[model samples]
Target: MIRRISAALLALGLATAAFAQAAWTDAEVRKVDAKTGKITLKHGEIKNLDMPPMTMVFTAKDKALLEGVKAGDHVQFAADKDAAGEYVLTAIQQKK
Candidate 1:
């Protein structure tokens, strides 16, 4: 019983760690191309992607992700590599 409880606690901790790994990253929108579903960002470190701060363009996972976002907006976002190994914006929101 004690071993089972310990295992459950360990699993819970691992789950929390995984969730934290997907935390939002800070960025400033440099450009937005709604027609192409792509946006350029000058961003801080993207921890999940193991990337350093840089300005680059990324395709949004969905064109709707570009809605209400515009160039020069300060934002927080999350990105992940797609099947083709290209970074795709998964989520984004303008900073308040």
Candidate 2:
């Protein structure tokens, strides 16, 4: 019974997280920490973040997310919220 309950709770959590209504804005890469897999950024407009204008450091999932992007380059992407409630770069594009 306990195992079943845990499984149900986990499923519910995953579903709720999958539909999260989060957003992102166009940002430029400031610097990347290869060791930590994090990137410092200068963001233009992150509507959902509601943060003040400044550079910020964020965790990156892998080195591939940094491909085709560089410091001072403009890019657009949205963060993805996983079942564990962690946000990561899920979509990205060079500003056109």
Candidate 3:
């Protein structure tokens, strides 16, 4: 019974680790509005939110997140809904 419990715990830990890794989605910056801390993205599946591919605007968690990136740049980003029920850009990185 002890061995079975240990195995279960190990499995649970691995599952948690996998889930903790944010599933980034491919996107292209369609627009950026620094004043409003929002960016428009044409993106593929956002796995964390179960959202299908689409083009939409998202508020960045911080306006500075838009720095060094601009319209037409291919990027990878992660987004999630904030407590205010607004979609917030959590991570963004330009694609090489």
Identify the leading candidate in terms of lDDT.
1
lDDT of each: 0.94, 0.69, 0.92
Give the TM-score comparing model 2 with the true structure, all chains together.
0.56
Q: Model 3: residues >4 Å from true position, as ranges?
A: 1-20
lDDT assessment of candidate 2: 0.69
Which residue pairs come into collision in candidate 2? Answer: none
TM-score of each: 0.78, 0.56, 0.78
Clashes of each: 0, 0, 0
* Clashing pairs for predicted structure model 3, backbone only: none
RMSD of each: 3.6, 6.0, 4.5
Clashing pairs in 1: none
Clashes (candidate 3)? 0
At residue 47, what lDDT does model 3 achieve?
Answer: 88
Q: Model 1 over residues 1-96: C-alpha lDDT tens digits?
A: 999999999999999998676669999999999999999999999987899999999999999999999998999999999999999999998887
